[model samples]
Target: MNLSVVIPAYRSERWVGRAIRSALAEGVADRNVIVVEDGVLDGTAQVVQATGARLTSLQRNGGAPHARNLGLAQVDTDYVMFLDADDYVENGLLAGLVGALERERADVAIGPWVYDGDGRERGMLRQPPALDNAERIFHWVMHAFFPPCCIAWRADAIRAIGGWDERLRKDQDGELVIRALIRDLKVAVSEQGNGVYWQHDSPHRVTKAQIKDVMYAADVVFAQLEGWVRSRIANGSAGDERVSLGRFCCKTAWVAYAYGDSAAGAKWSAKARELGFHNRGYNYRSALLASVLGIRISSRIKASTRLVYRRIAQR
Candidate 1:
């Protein structure tokens, strides 16, 4: 199967070469491994050139989604994959994902990924539940995440959905894939392959920033999801997605609290209550704690605990 892997590099001269090498090691032809340098002259293009991979340099920095869309425009292969410049794939992972798409006749195939940080292995990311398409999408909207490197897409199917949303600097992959799935794109799970997602403690990294800004970014994504769920409910096409959404809101409230956003935490928790999702054990425990400590104090406690854990992990 013809496949193209697009690696977007932005000020990643130190790591882009390794990413390129990993893609090449996947048995993909050097010519088919394209690197789009996202308007950074930080020797990233030079690194790409050194690997003999096709390099497309942008004149201005336009974030990852824009770079990915530009890369998508150049794809002439039947299937395409996106690899962040800091992350890499295991050997044969690309081929395996493509094979899954072909064998399952799917528009998209997602695989598992392992976390690598500070030159040590962390753990495998949790995979989404095994469910039919509709149920799976609901679960995905609720919580699960598949990083961009673990996903391969039928080129045409991605193009049909207008590529990635360039407006989003983070959560672009999740937003794009969820949008595609909501459009009824056939998706398959590739259980045999996995990729490496490098975790960084640096706040400058986009992934780290995603966590810091989770309240805002998550609300944006969840708004879209909630609208879709409401529409489905109105049309009598939804099952228990309403309850799932309420549970999702409750979960997000915890995240907000952990991130030190008490106002947002209370907002989402209230939304969950509005949706009649207060009977769960965790919810009951959280409510008891909040009643005793107040939301702001509760958020401070959660944030402090997270900070301590992060420092310990960093050590």
Candidate 2:
């Protein structure tokens, strides 16, 4: 097979048909577009079957990482790309991605991602066509390299690095891409890609713990990163930059709020003061959280805090 498009679907009967049709319309001859149905109640497997794409239903919903891993095991193609069942590619996606990979002779090819809702593009994360491994890492600092639907990668590169970390609730894509980069995997960015990432996530989505902290992946990743920092301090790990500890108390505070532990959130926000992250964004979020909880902090105190936030914003 020339290319494999792996779509891990769960409860996506409403959109799976369109997603499969989009891939078939792309006209990649001998292409394998495999949709793994993860215990979907909405007949998502039947939808893919009707679209003429092969379907493999999982016994249960095993999260994104598990579905991707299953897809990887099944693909026989030289190159592979992941696509969520709810998202579809716009016109010219197949030609752009496949051609870009062939021309660049890269181990992995990525492209720009556009967030769409009800047939309208709302947000786009654009990327340069060509980049080195180091540049790819920095580029990822801004946005994810693989939009799941935007990457065409050599099968060997994925297998060698052992694929993704299934343990993470979110940011599994980033972790996989980072592992590929750290191993010096050759990669390229597509010149054009109209892949649409449908926005179905809400303010309170499921997290690693499946409770609060819908965006809890960052904090867990941070803890792991701290370990890297410590090992490096002891002069361990020859390569790998010591896990970048720029003091993200701002992010820590948000993580706290997401986990539904207001006290923990407040503690992190207060610590942000000591860490010099007493900024407008974090402060505003803190106040919002405080407001929702009906905290006893009065209006005058809120005003003072807001002023302090503005001062930090200036910096």
Candidate 3:
């Protein structure tokens, strides 16, 4: 196998097969598609088999990276990439990505990632401000860097870094790439275009449920990322790690509140407030970031925040 394309399937029965087929069919190269079902409620394994793609099953749900590494370790592909079971790849995506990797002889190949709904583009995960001739991947972590799905990596390079850490539920991709950069790995960027990242938004669109879960994950991830920043500062890298850590803290704060953990979330909100992130609607993102920093939103501030809250209550 020259390429291993791993899809971590979790409750993705609606389109797990489609995601697999897209990997096998539209990819520009000969790569094996492995769909790892994480103890799903639906017949996700059956769906993978039905598509004639290889299937791997875990006895329980262990999040994305865990499912990915199971399939990843079994293959001998020269390169590896990941895709969420719910996401579908686009035409020319695989070929364009592979060509760039080969041309640059890069340990990893990256590109712009556009976020989309089932049929339309919703947003995009921006490439870093820059990937300088001499760059620091750790500095430009994309929520979690080198988006796992939008990237392809030399298999040996994957091993050299010991593969994805199964511990991370949210920012594993970013964590992995930064580790690679610390080892001074060479990464390539493609000029083909942004690869589509299909986001399965809620039909309700603005329910408490939708935003709540998002906050839960963000809260957890930011805590881990803070530790990562501290370790970096200890190593004497660049300016203050506080700036980055503070930014993540504020973002996690609002999500924590959205997810119904207002008490826990309030802590993040207050920390963000203390950090001086007081921009209006931007405060929504701020509230969540503050939550991660672990401080409480004063009852007085919470009461005041309610007046503006009604204007956007439905969403």
Candidate 4:
């Protein structure tokens, strides 16, 4: 199958070459490697041009979604895959994903990915079995899956859903895939690991520094999900599937507290309570403390506990 790979790059001169090389190594021709440079001329454009990949340089930084949409508009192949500039896919990843899609006649095919950085394997993000229904896909989204790098899509299928949400600065992949699943498209999952997502701890990375933007995106995603669930319930198509809004809210609350946004944390925890989510797991203690002492005080207590534990350990 003819496949086109899109890599959205910004200040990625250091690793964008490797990403392009990885795609080319998968037997994808140079003409099919499209790199959308998001207005950062940090020598990334030079590297991409040197590799002979088709380069589309935007006038200014428009974030990943914009770059991806721009790249999507340029796709002319049967299948398409996205690779972040800092990450590289394993050999044959494109062929593996395309083969799975063709064999299953699926609109999308996904494979497992490993999270690694600084020359060490951190862990794996495994794709669940083939999801055929909206409810199952919704459940998967509530848990925050990895990025879109692990999947390949039938180019037309993605266009049918209007591509990614350009307004979202984060969680764009989850939002896009969730809409596709809600539209009742078929999905095939390959258990074979094929992708690598580099985890960067640098504060410059959006994932590391954009907590507020991420939380805002989360709210939009969950709101859409809640609407979908309501629609499913109204149509009587929701089977044994339960909407895990409470769990989602609790998780969001924890994230807010961890990011030092106590007001947001308390608000989300209250929302979870309203949704009938009983904090029954590791969140139980923190939930209770946040409820009684407010998230700010509760967070302080937790921080002190961690500090004390570390001091004791060093003794």
Candidate 3's clash total is 23
Q: Clashes in model 4: which pairs?
A: none
TM-score leader = 1
lDDT of 1 by residue, 75-97 (tens): 99999999998888885678888
TM-score of each: 0.88, 0.71, 0.68, 0.86
Q: Write the per-residue lDDT of candidate 2 for residues 14-58, one digit (tens) a residue.
A: 887888787777774323888888775677877777777878898
lDDT of 4 at 81: 93
- The whole-model lDDT of each prediction reads 0.78, 0.64, 0.63, 0.78
Off by over 4 Å in 2: 29-31, 119-125, 128-131, 142-146, 201-216, 223-244, 247-249, 258-315
lDDT of 4: 0.78
Model 3: per-residue lDDT, tens digit, 46-130? 7777777778788788867788788888767678778877666665566667787788888888766666655443665556344
Best first by TM-score, ranked = 1, 4, 2, 3
Q: Please identify which of the two predictions, 2 or 4, would achieve the higher lDDT against the true structure.
A: 4
The number of clashing residue pairs in model 4 is: 0
Candidate 3, residue 278: the lDDT equals 46
The positional error of residue 229 in candidate 1, measured at the CA in angstroms, is 1.5
